[model samples]
Target: MAAFNFTPSDTSLFILMGIPGLEAAHIWISIPFFTFYIISLLGNFTVVFVVGKEQSLHKPMYLLICMLALTDIGMSTSIVPKALFIFWFNLKGITVNGCLAQMFFLYAIAIMHSAILVTMAFDRYVAICSPLRYTTILTNARIAKLGLVGLTRAVFFILPEPLFLSRLPFCANQIIPHTYCDHIVVAKMSCGDITVSRLYGLVIAVIVIGFDLTLIGLSYGLIIRAVLRISSKKANLKALKTCTAHICVMLTAYTPILFSILTHRFGQGITPHIHIILANLCFIVPPMLNPIIYGVKTKELRDKVGKCRRSSLAATDFKPA
Candidate 1:
C-alpha cells in the first residue's frame, strides 16, 4: 500500500467559489441569515437555561428538550458564525485541519440532534402510551444515564467522518465553495478514490438516521393507536396535538436529509446544486425553526420562557445598592 501522500494546501479560495460548479449567492443572503442565527441562539439558549433552572421542568420530556436545545445550539454554532464571516468579509479560506474540525463538530452535533429526537420520542411514548410506567421507566437517574448513553452514541457514530476527512489527500485546489466545511464537498475534493468514503458516509447515515427514523415512527404509531382507542374525543385530540410539533420538526429535519442523499447518489448534473441548497437548508432551517415550533405548540415551554423573563426583570428592578 502506497503511503497516503497528504499534502496540505496553502492556497485559499474564495468560499463562494469553493464548490465545483455552483455560484455564490449575493451578500444580501446574510441579512436574513443573521436574523435567523440570532433567534436560533436566543431560543435554544433560553430552553437550556429554563430547563436547567426550573425544578418542575426537570422531567424526562424537558430533559430531552434541554438536550435537543443544546444540540441545536451546537449545530448553529458550528455553521452560522463562520458562514456570516464568509459572507461579510469574504474570509472563506480554511486549512485542511480546520475544515476537518468543522466537519467533526457539524456532523457530530447533527447526529446528536437525531439521537436527542429519538430519546424525546421515547420519552413521549412512555408518557402517553405507558403512563402508568412512565415514572418507573424514566426516573431521574435513568434519564441521566440515557442522556449519557445518547451523547456517547452520537460521538462514536460521527467519529469516522472527521477521521476519514483527515486521512484524505487534498488536491491543489483547496477552496471550499460553500460557506462552511460540508462533508460531501470536502470528500469530493479528495485526490484519491472516495468510493469507500462515500460508502461509509452512506452506511453511517443509514445506521443513525435510519434507526432513529424507524424508532420515531414506531413510537408515533403506537401513540396514535393508543389515542384512537381512547373513549373521549377531547382526550384523543389533545394527545394528537401533543405530537404535532415533534412530527413537524422530524419532517423538516428528515426530508432534506433524504432529498440530499437521493440527489447526491442518483441525480445527475444540475441536481447537485439543488442537493447543496437542500443540504444547507437541512442544517440552517431546522435549527432556526425547531425552537419556534416547540414554543408555539408546547404551552409549557412558552410559559416557562415567559416566567423566566419576568423573573429576570423583577430581579433587575430590585437592586439594593
Candidate 2:
C-alpha cells in the first residue's frame, strides 16, 4: 500500500485522535485516564517522598525503586495528561516540536525504565546470590552511576528520532490516529521516505528491550539457583518471595508494550482502534500499577506509606490540645 502521506505540508501541527471509534465516549474515557494519571502521580510521588524522608529505606533496592518511580512518573506523564486534554477538552493539535519532545521523553524514559529494572534485577541477584558483596557491589554511588548510564544510553539512542522526523515532509495527514506522538505513527504521515525512522525505531526498541530482558533473565536464573541450593523449604520460599514484586513489575512493564509491538507488526488483521487502545493502556497501566504493586508487595514501602498516611491524617485531624 502507498504511504498515507497526502499533502506537502500541514501547519506544522499534528492533530491526535484520542480514540478513533469512541469519540462519543471520550468524556467517559477521560474519567479513567484522568483517574489513572492522578493515581500514578500520587503513588509514584509518595514512593519518592517516603523513600527520601526515611533513612532506613535508603538501601540500593529502595533507591532503585525510587528511580523506577521517577521513570513511571515521566513515562505516564508524557502521554496521559495530553490524552486527557484531548478527550475532555477536544484539544488535539500538537506542534511539531511539541510532538517531538513528547515522543523523546516517552521513548527515552521507557527504555531507561527497562534499564532500571535490569539494574534492580542485578540488585536482587547480588543480594540473593552474593549476600556478602551486595553492598560492596552496589553502593549508592554505583547505583547513581548506573542510573546515569541508563539515562545516557536511552538518550543517545533516541536523540536521532526527532532529527529523522524533522526532515520528513508531512504534506498530507497531520492527524495521528492515536492519543500520543508515537514515532512510527508520525513517520507514516510524512511524504518523505521513512525507512530510516522505521528501521531505527525497530532497532532501538529491540536492542534496549531485548538486551535488558536477557540480562534480567540471566540474573534471575542465577538467583533462583542460589535460592534453591539453600535446601530449606522455608528459606527457599522466603527468597523466592522477594522476587515476586520485581517479577510482577517486570510483567507490567513489558507485557503490554511487547503485545503492542507484535500486533503492530504481525497482527495486521487487528483494527486501528484496538491498536490504539492497547497502546494507550501500554502507557497508562504500568504507571498506575507500579507504585501500588511496590507499596503492597514490599513490606517496608507498605509500612512507610501507611505511616505517611497516618501522619498526614493526624496532622489534618489535630485537636488544639
Candidate 3:
C-alpha cells in the first residue's frame, strides 16, 4: 500500500480553551498534572511495596489489588507524560506511525485494566460465595494465568485499531483534535470514510467494556444473593464491607467511560467539552482515587501504609552523617 501524504490542519478544535495558546495553557496545566502524576505514582507504589513486603497480603484479594495498582500505573504512564510534553512544549506534531503507536498502547493498557477489574470481581465473588474453595481456586498460579490472559486479550483486541488507523488516508488534517492521539480523534482526521473504523471502535467497546461490565454485574448479583442468605448479621456486614472498596473502584472506572460514549454518540458536538472532560476523568480519576478508596475502606492496607511511612521516617532520622 502507498503511503498517504497528509497535511496538518490549522484549526485547533478540541485544543485546550481558556488560554492564549497551547503553550500557555500547557504550562499552567503541567503544574497540576505533574503534581497528580507524582501522587498517583507514590500511591500506587505504596500499594505495591506494602503488598510485596508483607507475606500476610499474599492472598487472592490483595494480589488482585497489587495487579490493579500495576495496571493503573501503566494506564497513566502511557498517555499523561506525552500529552503534557506536547501541549506544554508546543510539540504538537506526530508522524502517522507515532500516532498509531500511541493509540495502540493507550487503548491496550486501558482494556487490560478493564479486564483485570472483571477478574477481580470474580475473585471477590468466589471469596464471598465459596470461602472454602477460594484458596483452591484462586491460587498463585491461577492469578498469574489470569493476568496473562488479560494481557493477551488487550494485545489481540487492540491490534485492529492501529492497523485500521494506518490504512486510512490522512489528507490535510494531521492535527488531532485532542491532546493525545485518541482513536476517534485520529479517525476524524482521516479524509477517507471512517465507517469501518467507527464500527470497529463500537465493536471493541462492546467486547471490552460492555462484556466486562456485564460479567461484573453478574458477579455482584450472585454475591448479593449469597450475602442475603447469610443468617448472621455480623457475617453479612463483613461481606458488605469487603465488597465496598471493589464496588467503589468499579463505579469510578466505568461511570465516566459510559458517560463519554453516550455524550459522543448521542450528544454530538454540542457537548464536546463534556466529552473531553469525562475522557480525562475516565483515565485519571480512577487511578488517583483508587488508592484512596482502598485506604479508607480496607483497614489492613491503611495500617500497612502507615507502618511503611513510619519506618521510612525512622530510617531518615537515623541516617549516617
Name the top lDDT candidate: 2
| Model 2 Cα shift for residue 160 (angstroms) | 0.6
Give the higher-lDDT candidate: 1 or 2.
Answer: 2
All candidates' TM-scores? 0.89, 0.95, 0.89
Steric collisions counted per model = 3, 4, 0
Pairs with steric clashes in candidate 2: 7-171, 7-172, 8-171, 9-171
Candidate 2: worst-modelled 10 consecutive residues by lDDT: 1-10
Clashing pairs in 1: 18-176, 18-177, 19-177
- Name the TM-score of candidate 1: 0.89
Pairs that clash in candidate 3: none
Candidate 3 wrongly placed segments (more than 4 Å): 1-24, 269-271, 319-321
What is the Cα-based lDDT of residue 133 in candidate 3? 93
lDDT of 1 by residue, 1-321 (tens): 011222345333313332235435636677777888888898888888888999999988888778787888888788778777766665555556777788888888898888878878888888889899989999888877877887788788778887886777767766566767777778888788887778888788889888999999899899988988999999988888887888888887888888877777777775555665566677887887888888898899899889999999999899796
Order the candidates by lDDT, highest first. 2, 3, 1
Clashes, model 1: 3
Candidate 3 lDDT over residue span 1-321, tens digit each: 011222335322223221223445567766766777778888988999999998988877888899999888987787678667654665555566777887898889899889889988999999899999988999988998999999999999999998987787765545455666788878887788899998998899898887998999999999999999999999999998888999999998988888887887788755454565567667777888898889899898899889989999999899687
